[model samples]
Structure formats: structure tokens, C-alpha cells
Target: MVEIFGIAVSMDPIWLTLEVAGWTTLILLLLGTPLAWWMARLQSSSKIVLEALVALPLVLPPTVLGFYLLIILNPNGYVTEFLRLFGFEGQLTFSKTGLIVGSVFYSLPFAVQPLMHAFEAVPQKLLDAAATMRANAFDRFFTIAMPLSQRGFLVAATLTFAHTIGEFGVVLMLGGNVPGETRMVSIDIFDHVESLEYDQAHLLSAMMLIFSLCVLMLVYALNRRFGVKVG
Candidate 1:
């Protein structure tokens, strides 16, 4: 819905942003937690290679990542080829699902690194003691490691969600500016600014700034309250 007389407003971008952010955070939580655990306990040289791949997005420019992702997600590329086997007939680009995939990769390190460090911080003696009691690796991980790494989960979830909201380049490149579809808050703000609609841009940008600040503050506060050091 477009507002001409400054009367009505639409919530499409907000909803899309939330939908992608929520699902991206959830996927990272489910995927990143175990990967972080594996990385934490890995002693082999291959671990370095895997860690580098996971962390590469952190240093890589968003446009660069988006460019490669767009290639892979193209109709003739690996992602679509694989999905075709499962009967999914559609393009990933300019869609909400594509945005989720891109966001997951772009925001991967934000979820993994914190949890990796947290998992690494778990005392080895704890595992040793659990082993002495015949506790399986699964048992020990759930009963000991995960319980102690609550701070990492909190930090990872918070950071990923916030980071996904602020993502502009990856979203723009991978998802494009399709309203009621992939056009998120960040992209909307960009469009507004490009068209010199400063008022609308400011309104959305301020909300993003405040939301990000609050998320970070909550992370620090929660960590402090639980005496959980994320570093």
C-alpha cells in the first residue's frame, strides 16, 4: 500500500524482514550450534579449513558474497539443480526463500563464532568427569556443554537477528526490490533515500537503529546478569 497524503501505511516490509530474520536465526541456531560444537572439539588440520570457510563471509564484502550466491542459486546452478530433484520449480532469486538462504550464509559467522568460543570455553575436566560416570558424548553435551553455553546461544541469536535486519547489500543483490516479497526494511529505507523520501527513510532507519541498540544492550545485560563471558 502506498501513502500519498500521509494517511495509510503498509506492513509488508516489516513482516518480510521479520519472517526472514526469524527463520534465518532459527536455521543458524539449529545448524550453527552443532557446527560450533564440532569445531570446538576438532583437533585435525581439516578443522582449520572448515573454520575458514565459515568465517570467510565475515571478511568478504557483501556484494562479493551475494554475487557468488546469486550464481549458485541461479536456475542452472547447484542450488536450483538440487532443488529440482525435490520438485521445487521456481527461481530462488527475488524471492523470500532466496533471501533466507543468502541471509543464512551472510550471517553465519555471527552465529557460529560466538558459540564456538563458548563451546571451547567449557572446561575439559567437565567432559572427563562425565566420561568417568559413563556419560555418552550426547549426554555430556546436553547436560554439561549446552547448559554452560547459554550465553553463546543468547549472543548468537541476538546478533544474527539484528545483523539480518541491517543487511542491505546481500538482500538487495540476492532478493531484489520486490514489494510484498523480498523487499525488507533495509531495502525499503534504501529505496526511500534514493527517491529523496527522507521522512519515510528516517522513520524506518531510526527504528532499525533503536532495535539494534536494544538487542546489543540486551545481549550485554544478559551476559552480565548470568556472569557469562562471550569473549
Candidate 2:
């Protein structure tokens, strides 16, 4: 029930936005890490195809992605049907969970690319030395690569979370603007504009701009400090 610039805006949208972004970032870290590791080491034609698919969302229009997701995630869509076989009883469409799924897909490239760079930046000689010591892949990844790639982790997480905040069309298509559920700040801003609530729109827009700037600044500051420590 908080008012921004005298335009009433619910905190629910803010919380939901964070919830979706949080889930998206968490999932990206868990899944994108191993995928990025494998991508860094891969050297094959299929790697090119996989990379293209991962990067598609970066270049593709949000509406295009949202449209396809809507089809695929509908209650009777193939994906839902597959889930139903495992005791699922709900549709992904129009739900906060749907927003998270869409956000993860939309932000996949941001997470993966940073992590791939980080993983690849690990010195080959160090890995080779570890191999000579009979250190397995798991051990090397945890003990060597992970430590050296902290910057990449930070970059990936920051980029993914920020990108999720800017999502609009995908969430709109998949989750609508349902309050206390799937509504995000971006959608709220849109609702304000559509309702001719310019004051609210301006406030939300300025807040997002400031928040994004702060996130970028923090990332740069942390990266600088980490680099000094590494050097």
C-alpha cells in the first residue's frame, strides 16, 4: 500500500519481482555453472549449435520468446503434459513459477557467458599440474577453477538478477500482471502507464534506473577490489 509520487503502488509487486529474480538467479547459478564448465572445455560442432541456442534469447525479441513459451507452457502444452506424468496438476501459464521459468531462460546467456569466461580463464598449466597430482575433475573444479573464477560468479549473478528485473513481454505473456503473484515492477510500471498514472510510472522508472546503476557500480567496485587481491 505504499505510495510512490502520490500514485498508490503495492509492495507485492516489488516482492514478487525479487522472488522471481531470486529464483532465476539461483537456478542459473546451479545449472549454468556445470553447463558453462562443459562449454568452456567443449571443442566440437555441436558446441557451436548449443552456444547459438543459448545466445538466442540475447538477440531474440522478448515477445518472440514469450509467444513460444506461452505455447509450450500452457496447461495442455507438451511441457505441461510431460510434467503431468510425474504428478503435476497445475499450469505454468499465468503463475509466478512461469515468470521464474521465463526469466531463467531469458537470462540464461548472461549467467552462462560470464561463467564460461571465468571457467576458461583458469590457467591450463594449473589444471595440468593438478592432473599430475591425481586430482579428479570434481576436485580440480572445486579447488582450482572455482577459486580463480569468483569474479565470473559475481558478474554472472549480478547480470542475471538485473536482467530479470528488466523482463516484461515474457512475463506478461506467461504470467500476466496478477497482483501478489506474478506481477513484477516492470509490469507495474506498464500498468501505471496504461492507466495514465504518469506520476507512478515516472517514479518506478527512475527507481529502476537508479537501482540498476547501483548494481553495476557495486559490481565494478567489487571486481576492482577482487582484481587487486588477485594481482
Candidate 3:
């Protein structure tokens, strides 16, 4: 048991939550960067459709998303079967992997929306100048676009990490409560509440509230400092 302010509590969920948030943020940064770049540069009428798809998670309920993910990652589901074709023999549902996947999906908008705005805010003139200097698309992106959008990257990563840490419904539905394997802080708090452990629940809930407030404050401070608009 870990003690927080003289209250006994398990640290497993805390560590697991950090691990999931870290992995989700890293994966989102890697994948969202390219997707955001593409979306920012899109000039076709289909851009709206693609943007809507990317932003779907924002409007979609976490439980609904989680329920679908549970189905897809189940033993006999398409995702599990697809992975089996590559010699993988592990289950996704009720596992840490499932939590990370759900977090990534649930927090996709937090990662992509900021990044897209940042990429879009990059000056076309700068990219055009880079092109005149024989810079390839990759070079222009890595050098000019990425550097200009540094604040956006910060916003995206911060929001994604914070959002993932606070996830409950999606994680619960997809990963269930498997103790050290899949029980996150949110679920742990839920368990405490269910078992009539108000003291423990209050402690955990207060911690979450404080942590969430701090994260939001930090994001807002960054937005002000860098003049980046995060939505």
C-alpha cells in the first residue's frame, strides 16, 4: 500500500495510468502529426469529411466508443484475428493494450485538432520558399512547418496525455478491472466508491480534480505564452 497524506492506497493504478498516458501520447504524436499535416494541406472538398471523421471522438460518447472497441478487440473479433495472421497470440480486450488503444481513440481529437490548427497556421510562404531551395516535402515539413508549429505540438501532447489520464468509461468497458493489469486510477476510484470507502474515494477524486485543474492551467498558460489557440 502506498500512503498519500497518511491515507493508505495502492500505487499500481497510478503507475499504470502514467504508463498508459505516456504510450498514448507518444503514439498519438507519431500518428497524429502526419495525419494533421495532410489534413492541413488538403484542398479538396473531401477535407470536411475527413476532418469530421477525425473529430468524431469529440462528439462520441466514451461508453459507446468503448463498447465498439470491446467488440473489435475481442478474441473472435476482426482486429484480434488480423493480428493473429501475423503470429500474435495475445488478447487485446481486458488487457493493458486495450486501455492504451481506447485512450488513443478517445483522445484522438485532443491530439489531432490542435496539431491540425498548428500545421494550418504555418506560413505557406515559408514552405514555398523552402521548396524554391530544393527542399522536398519532408524537408519542408520537418524544418519549416514543424518548427513553426512547436506550440501546437505542445498543446496536443499535453491535452492528449491529460485526457488519457482522466479516461474512465472507455477504459472500463474495454479493459475491465483486472487489478495491476488494467485497473486505472479512475476505475480504482470507482471501486472505492462502490465499496463504501468514501474516505479513499474522496482522496483519489480530489487528487484527480487537482491534477486535472493543474493540467488545464498549464495548457492555458502555454496557449497564452505562445499565442497558440487550442480548442
Candidate 4:
């Protein structure tokens, strides 16, 4: 516990939040990159449907998403039953794993949209030139598309990490509030307020505000420095 303005505050939630954010960001980067790449290159009309599905979390209420996820991840849920067939009977809901799953879903758009735009922004002419050189799609993506999309990668990672850190509804609904396991910084602040610990809540909220502002500032600065136009 650390004393802030004479109030003892536990740091467990902060560390746990960072841990979850780290995992969520890593998983999104790995999974979203390929999905974004595929979506960006698709020429069919179905691309719109795919994009809408990927972007659903952006418009959907967090509680609604969380509620559905809870159903899917609970002890008697299909996911658990399927895992049991493979001798894995561990619970997901009310655990850190549930928090990570919910965060990944909630933050999917933040990762995918920017990456898709970046992949789209890669000049088709450049890809054509690479194709002329006998470079395969896999080689071209790694050597050309990925290098050109570095800025987008940075933005995606920053946004994903920050968004995960600030997650509340999904984490709350799926993981509940288990200290040192699933309790995130946002939930900790909420708890403080609910307990009438105004000083602690204010302190935590202020920290989050400052951190979010700094992340946005950094993203904008990098974009401007790299001559990337933001809409």
C-alpha cells in the first residue's frame, strides 16, 4: 500500500491492469495484423460485412458485450465444455483469463481499424512492382506492407494498451472484482467511489486522465513527425 494524501492505496490493481493490458495488446497485434491485411486486400462486397463485424465493439454498449461474453465464458458455458474435452477444466469467468478475453474483444476495433487503413494505404503500385519481381504475397507483406505501416502499428498498440487499461464494464461483468487477479485500475477507482473514498478515487481518476492524454499526445506527435495525415 502507498499513502496518497494520507490515504492508503493498494497498488495491486494497477499492476494487474498493466499485466492485462500487455497481454491484450500482444494478442491483438498478432491476431489483428493478418485479419486486417486480409480485409484490406479483399475486393468482394462481403468486405463491408467483415468490417462491420470487426467494428461492432466500437458502437455496441460495453455492458451488452460484457453480458454476452459472460454467458460464453461462464463455468457451464460452451467454451468451458469444449475445453474439458481436451482435459482443460479451468474456469474463465471471474478470472484474469476472462478479463483478457473481454479486453481483447472490446479493444478489437482499436487494433484492427488502424491496421486495415495502414495496409490499404500501402501503394498498390508498390505491390505490383514487387509482384513483378517474383516476390510472393507473404514476402511482400513482411518486407513491404509491414514496413510501410509502422506508424499505424504504433498507433494501434498505443490505443489498444490504453483502452485495455481503461476497460470497466466488460472486465467487471466477466471477471468481477478479484484483487490481485481480475481487479483493474478502472474497477479499483469505481470501488473507491462506491465506498465513499473520494480522495482515492480522485487520485486514481486523475492518474488515468493524465496517462490517456499523454498517450494521445504521443500518437499525434509521431503521426505529425512522420507526415501521416489524421482524419
Candidate 5:
């Protein structure tokens, strides 16, 4: 078992997992909400394709996803090449930023699906009523659709955070387990397993399992409580 500053670093995995999870959730909320709302309201024939694309990460192997990310974000790759045109070096792979981007994609379905369902549940009559009251699109979203779908937002945030916490393949492929930078709990657990530190692995694994359960329970409880409130 590793020790950091006199504390069992194995136990520290919880904190590390929570930190990444929290950030990943925030990113999803900030970005996914608009996308979900758009998807929910869209009547276009392309909506199905777009939603499938959003859900692609769930089915794609993390290693395959990571490999493509590597190709796109490498020092000499598309993103970096674009940056190079502006006299900047954008090194995304094997970095903290890369880990975050990969986590967002990895957990996107969990975030988008719930929000989409929530938005879908909003009665079109409510939006029409808002429009009759001279409410703009933004006003309708904020005052009508969003408030009604708050429970789904809560569930999405919790699930996305929890799911990102356990991400291993994408993080390993993109971040390469660099300590204190991109080496998160899942990677740490893998390292421990490789080193044959069974006890450490057990401790970390147990902590993650417990944390995930708690988060999921919280989601269900909150959704149930507020669901009643909404009703």
C-alpha cells in the first residue's frame, strides 16, 4: 500500500475519483443541457442520427475511442496542427486536459439521455403558453422546460459523475497514468494489480464501489422526492 503524506494513498483514490467525477459532471451539465434540449425539441429526420452519434461512446470500446483521440490530439495531429498554424503547441494526449475531454465523451450518454427524456416530458402546451405570454425561446427554456426537468438534470449529473469515476481504458490510453497529473484512482488500481498489491487494489475497489452506490442512491432518492414535488 502506498502512503502519501503519512496517509494511506490507497484510500486517497476516493478523493481523486470524486475530483475528476465532479469536474466531468460539471462539463456535461454545461454542454449537454443545450444539446439535449435541442435534441428533445427537434423534429428533423436527422435527429435520430445525431442522437445515435451522441450515444456512440457508450458502445465504442474505450481503447478505440482513446486511440482516435490520440490521433486527433497528438502533438502533430489535427488539433495540434491547427494550433501550430497560430504559433502554439497544443499537446493534448497524455495530459490532464486530454483525460477530461475523454471522460466527457465516455460519460456523455449518461448525461444526455436523461436530460433528453426530461425535455421530452415537458408538455408542448407549456411552451405554447409561454409563447403566448411573449416569452422568447430562452425564457421558455428557463422558466418552463428547465424548471420542470430539474429532476432529470439532477439524475444526469449524478450518473455522469459516477460513471466517469470508474473510467480506466480511456484515461490510461490518453493520460498514460502520469502521477498527480492524470493518474486517477482507476489507473492507480490497475497499477496496484500489476504490482500484485491485492490489499491496495481491494481497498481502492471497495471505495469506488461504495462511492458509486452512494451516488446512485442519492440520484434515486432525489429524483423520487422531487418527482413527488413536481407532481
Candidate 6:
């Protein structure tokens, strides 16, 4: 970062990426954990429909997600008007908050899939045993399910963070390339490339590549260690 023409120039988008991705992963984990657990245990006819809705973003084009969010979050949009009753104006898009939301939607699969698998992997026998011992649902979840699913949780978190770090279209659509706020690493690289700044683009790209590799490696190592422990 440098001060140029009375404005700060930041070449490091990693911090911003982490900020958006971190909050996104945090929110996803908190929200997704329960939903995933519920979904995993669900046996109703609507299970497939709900599962498809949750996984829709994975297959949807990032641009499509961004475009719809952009329209819905515009100042005069329906959602914005709905928020006006509370003495607040809608300003989700074109800000860091929108960027985070975009990241979360884009990275939902990274958060949900692992958790669903984790919940599924929990032995029904153990849960039955806990229930027989008079443990409530919450107790069973905390004592038996969560602890055993630590590896999946870790992997989900790491992948969500990494995936969000590389987000571009959604961030661009929602954030509009605002620097130091919504211009995440991927957007930064895009800006550099557009400006013919190959060196800067390479620097940011390399950082992203390294960060993703490290996160994946860490997740794998943890999974291996936990697998051995479980075995």
C-alpha cells in the first residue's frame, strides 16, 4: 500500500479477500451447520427439492447470481424497499457487505457439502446410544456429532475461505470494483490485467495460488490425522 495523489494505493488484496471470505465462512458455518444437520436427517419427500435449492448456487453461473443480487439489492429494488420500513435505506450492494453476501452464496457448497457428509458419517448407533442414555438432541449434537465432525468442519471452512478468495464475477457485480473495500484479490488481479500491469497481476495471482494450496494442504493433513485418530 502506498499513498499516491492523496489516495491510498493498495496492491495487497489478500487482506481484503480474507476479510470478505472470513466473514462469509463464519456466517456460512453458523447458518449452514444447523441446516446441513437438518437436511442430512431429513427423510421427507421435499428433501430432494430442498437439497437442490441449497446446491443451486454451485451450478449457477457466478454472473447470474451477481446479476440477480445486483437487481434485488439496488436502492429502489424490492428488497431495498422492504428494508425502508425500519428507518434504514437498502445499501447492501456496491459495498463490502454485498461482497460478503456474494461470497457466501458462491461458496455455499464449500460450507454445506462437507457438513452434510459429516452429519451423514455420524453413526446412527452412537446417536441411539446417546438417546437411550437420556441425552437431548442438543446434547447429542454437541457431545457426539460435532466433536467427531471436526475434520469436516475444518475442511469446509478452509475450502469456503479459499473459494471466496478467488471470487470475481459476484464480487464485481455486487461490489463494482471498489478498492480497499470490495475489490478482493481476484478483482484486483482483473484490474491489474485490464490496466496492462502484468507484474502486479502476477503478484496477486501467485499469492492467491499459494494461499489456496496451503489451505487445501492443511485441510488434507488434518483429515489424515483425524482419520487415523478415528481408526
Provide the clashing-pair count of each candidate structure: 0, 0, 0, 0, 0, 0
The list of candidate 4 runs beyond 4 A from truth reads: 228-231
Candidate 5, 105: how far from true, in Å? 0.9
**Number of the top-ranking candidate, with TM-score as the measure:** 3
- On the 0 to 100 scale, the lDDT of residue 82 in model 4 is 91
Per-residue lDDT of model 4, residues 1-231, tens digit only? 998878789999999999999999999999999999999999999999999999999899899999999988888988989988999857889988888989999999999998999999999999989999999999899988998998889989999999999988898899999889999999999999999999999999999999999999998887887644532
lDDT tens readout by residue for model 3, 25-59: 99999999999999999999999999998898888
What is the Å distance of residue 49 in model 5 from its true position? 0.6
Ranking 3 against 5 by lDDT, winner: 3
Clashes of 5: 0
Q: Which residues of candidate 3, in runs, are more than 4 Å off?
A: 228-231
Off by over 4 Å in 2: 4-7
Q: Which pairs clash (backbone N, Cα, C closer than 3 Å) in model 4? A: none
TM-score: which is higher, 1 or 6?
Answer: 1
Best candidate per lDDT, number? 3
Which residue ranges in model 6 land beyond 4 Å of their true spot?
2-12, 87-90
Clash count, predicted structure 6: 0
Q: Worst lDDT window (10 residues) for model 2?
A: 222-231
**Per-residue C-alpha lDDT of model 5 across residues 51-162, encoded as one tens digit per residue:** 9999999999999988888887888777878877888754778877778888998999999999999999999998999999999999999999999999999999888988
| lDDT measured at residue 222 in model 6 versus the true structure, 0 to 100 | 85
Per-candidate RMSD, Å: 2.4, 1.5, 2.0, 1.9, 2.5, 3.2
TM-score of 1: 0.93
Question: After superposition, which runs of candidate 5 have C-alpha atoms over 4 Å from their true positions?
Answer: 1-7, 10-16, 84-90
Residues 119-169 of candidate 6 have per-residue lDDT tens digits of: 888998999999999999999999999998887898899889888888888
The CA lDDT at 49 in model 6 is 92
